[model samples]
Target chain A: MQKHFITLLFTLSLTGLNFANAYEMETTFHGVLDLRATVTDSLTGNYTQGGYGKFALNDGESFTLAQAGGEIALNWDNGLSVHAVANAYKNNGDFKLGLTEGYIKYSGLPNASGYRWQSKLGVFYPKISLENNAYAWASKNTLNSSSLNTWIGEEIRVLGNEITLTRLGRINKDPFDLSLTVSAFVNNDPAGSMLSWHGWTISNRQTLYTEKIQLPYFKARMQGYDLYEQASSSDPFLEVDDRVGGHVRAEIKFHKKGAISAGYYNNNGKPYIVDNGQYAWKTRFTHIDLTWLLPQGIVLTSQLLHGDTLMQSPLKTDVVNNDYTNGYIALSKRIKAHRITSRIERFNVKDNDKTVGDNNTERGKAFTLNYTYRLSKPWFLSTEFTWIDSYRPGRMYTNQPINLTERQLAFAARYFY
Target chain B: MFNKLPIQIKFLFISFFIIFAPSFVANATNTLTVNVVDTNQKPLENMVVYVEPIGHKVTLKNTNTLEIGQANKAFIPYISVMQLGSKVKFNNQDNITHHIYSPVGDNKFSVKIRSGQEVIKNDFNEAGEVSMGCNIHDWMSGYMLIVDTPFFAKSDKNGNTEMVIDKSGQYKVVVWHPQMTDINNRITKTINLNSAMAVTMQLSKPMDEIPSQQNEDDFDFLSDY
Candidate 1:
């Protein structure tokens, strides 16, 4: 299926390019290679080593290749364009190279009902992140994304079609514009498993498309419960409980200064049914985000998210219900080419089902401060410090759960062209 | 030696040069210094100053192609000054497609220009303020002031302009800017340029509001969705 999708994408892109040759073709290529040195300290001595079931770290300092990716966009005179991105890196030891996203977009929609309509059909991430506005889905300010956005990067992508309608206010001599977005997708049934497994984590790593992630806690729990081995590695894009799911988003803008947006996402699949070691999560979430451009190059941004996922049997006796909530507030200021940003985030996940041996209970808070100095238009040097405070009752490998506070300092040099 | 000479010799020498020398050397050029300012007296940039010859025709000899480049989603020169019959070329230097058009201008036409691609030249045969806009980019805007005379100058940041008119006669000096509120009632001065001198003009009304250069991220979406 993936191969067929790629072939179709190439054929369409080439066709667009050929048509563009009759007129004009404007193509752009942009990328960033971020090299970083990181030092992490954990209080519980449980180094954050395991992926998802992060028990402890490597618990040391090391120079690492943080992220490297790029995107290519080809535009034509006839309002046809194609965009694609690929990334290769190790997210704390899970190394893989994968196509991040690819899409064919048609933007020349006529204005009707005081609105203009556009559509995109491909594999792409939804326009949900107010922070990841930079190239290759990287955060503009800090090295790592916020906890909520990090989860979004890990497990959410629309592998289908998205339609957008926008009312251009200033173009019509109005003071404000409004927009609505609707997307239908598939091949993402495994979206909510990691959210239930790890609760929420703060990191700069994005899970690749084909990478195999290890879930130690799930493996241990299966073994401890005397159940059959349910595979050690998880694939986020497996088709399970084959179904189509979607989301809708609405946005309103006040001139060119600020905007407010709200969205609701749901994958209404049956989690009780599993296929190819993947389960349908029956997950849903409500997201609200705001961006305000303050005076003097200062910006204020905030996002609030609430959601739940459930997996259980037909009788509903043996079930696991995970309720997750997270929110973040950020302030950023730009002085010429230099930008400084700081954010505070809080997240929590509880086992509302109260099932036996439920290891999905965790609550955490994180604070991050970042500074970026742009040496030139494409070269940037930045430093970020993040501290997370949390208590996980299920992390009792030593037969005792400990309240943990982890701190990491990272310095990176990046070039985007 | 000239002082020792007769007053008639000095007068004849001066008269000889003044009459026949001007015919030989063609010293009809006179410098027209124009100082333009806002109500606050700040030197306004991108204002065009030109001399319109009255009772006679001043033929324009030098005509060139004017380029209006689109870079970073903006017209390189926010305001363009051109003479009648001047050919203008729109170049897209940025890595994107630019659909350029003038809705209400002397030359009303539209063309889709792509990166690294060239479009057909546009000729400004009529004299008027051509308000240009991009169909693709809503916030992108520009202006082209087309005039009949070649003796025009766009004011610098210091709001100072100097045009060397190769003619001495009664001429009407006119100034234009994109932000000018009254295009019909422009600030004009009728002057007799027998010699080089300085002239200052003040705008009777404040300039129209300059278009805002909002960030590109402000309207990340192309349509309402």
Candidate 2:
């Protein structure tokens, strides 16, 4: 809606630039209204593993969720500002909320040698690692650093509209920040094989960002998307909104907390998928990511994600390719109140044109451990352990060959404000 | 140089060093600036905030405060508050080889950190928030928030905070957390320290909500810890 009628004509031109008598404009606001609860148990995994803390964090057994959310603020005495965070959840069945930040900020700008320039806009989270933008209880791995979620966003996650450019270095000097973006959403393009996106077409909506001059530390990002859905059958000259496709990502952040992320997806089909009668009423994807930051703060994340879902259409003709490989190598140590964590991950999925069970290929290996204690204003404690090894092979249709293993344990305590 | 020295010996050495460095001993010093926010005003980035310098008197020449580390198996500045006996210097920088400790409280301290090793004195005078782990890494964790007030700060990255109360009263404005359910807890507020302005604590819930590196203990679903 033209960004909501140009933000109501810029707040009615700021009340028509000081409407006569009555004075207006005074601001200061704060934030937070959070709530959470989690439980899971999967020794051999299910619910698509990938995370829920790897097969439900073993030892006992459970799968639970109770969550709430908050964050709404505004402050301006000059430097101006805005803040947001909205959360919601329900999973055992499925449910969620929206937005973490809607953006609109400024640090006054105007300055040279003193250096500092900040600006934001709608949808936030992503500057990569340190757990990106923490707060799931300050994270120690609720399982997210799977190598940038298979290339830039398996769960590095996303929203849209971003513009950031900063250069403020002085710890004797060495802090540089740069960001350029163009975002629009309603994603999961799947190369125009549309299985989702009923929001009245935009071809599954996706615009992407990160492309502009980069300096001091060098950074880059580019995401592409394409979707189209309209079907009468599986094929009939494939009617996907005038043929569209999406996928492309590149990420880089050097030295100080190193980072290297890469992505390339070519999903040729997916429109709200549903038809697990042996794999996919949908599935077509490819993802990759990698990271490192260990100078006494351990963070050696890794990922080589690869996914493929195809039951039909190589583009209304010759087709064949179904692969999924996920990788992992993560280490974390967030100070204060003690915390110790460990992880080792691996997943491999296959069906390079079928040669066994459900068309063949599936592998999983995961191991983890954690402990935390922060006592001083309210005691906080945590403990955990996990292990899983899964494999599947046999039966082009039925020779049956599958094995699953699991072990998990977890503990938690909190009372924050 | 050869052309200057004679002007009354450079005006008597810049007027005897700007008029005798405060009479050489009468002594006088001043400096204060603190800023922070949260509660929606945002601007609280790293957040650690502290304050408690009422009566103990001057004893800090600043040596880059204090920070220690160990990696992966825990400890790396998750939280470290000082002043009250100060002195902390633990280092391992990780190459695998740790057995850190803190058996009892009030300043217990233990050791066993290999790999590029290092471990300085260890003299905490007690305020609270001391915890460390590593029975062979066991997912090593850390926290040392020992404070006694002289004022404190930690909230940047947009969360904001400012403190410099040399002698302010009603000293019970609490907001400390290791996860805070009770640790001699406090949440009172009265702060009237003459104001230069700064005080915010925006956190919906961030005291280790758990998500920074995964592996949150694997599963017990908390019926007991």
lDDT of each: 0.73, 0.41
Candidate closest to the true structure, highest TM-score: 1
- Best of the candidates, DockQ: 1
Give interface RMSD for all predictions: 6.7, 20.1
Fraction of true contacts kept, per model?
Answer: 0.05, 0.00
Segments in model 2 whose C-alpha atoms lie over 4 Å from true places: A1-150, A153-184, A187-307, A311-321, A331-351, A354-417, B1-225
Model 1 compared with the native: what TM-score? 0.77
Among all windows of 10 consecutive residues in model 2 chain A, the one with the lowest summed lDDT is: A197-206
Interface RMSD of 1: 6.7
lDDT of 2: 0.41
| lDDT, model 1, position A132 | 74
> A1-417 in candidate 2: lDDT tens per residue?
225324633553453344312432233222222222334444222222211122312224444332333444444334344554455434444444544334444443323332334444444433333332333212334332332232332212233333433332211123222223223322222321111110001000011222110111001101221111222112111213222333444454443455565555442334334231111223434444555667876666665655554544324321224555656666767676676767677766555652111223556677666666665433456565556665644211222224645554555553333
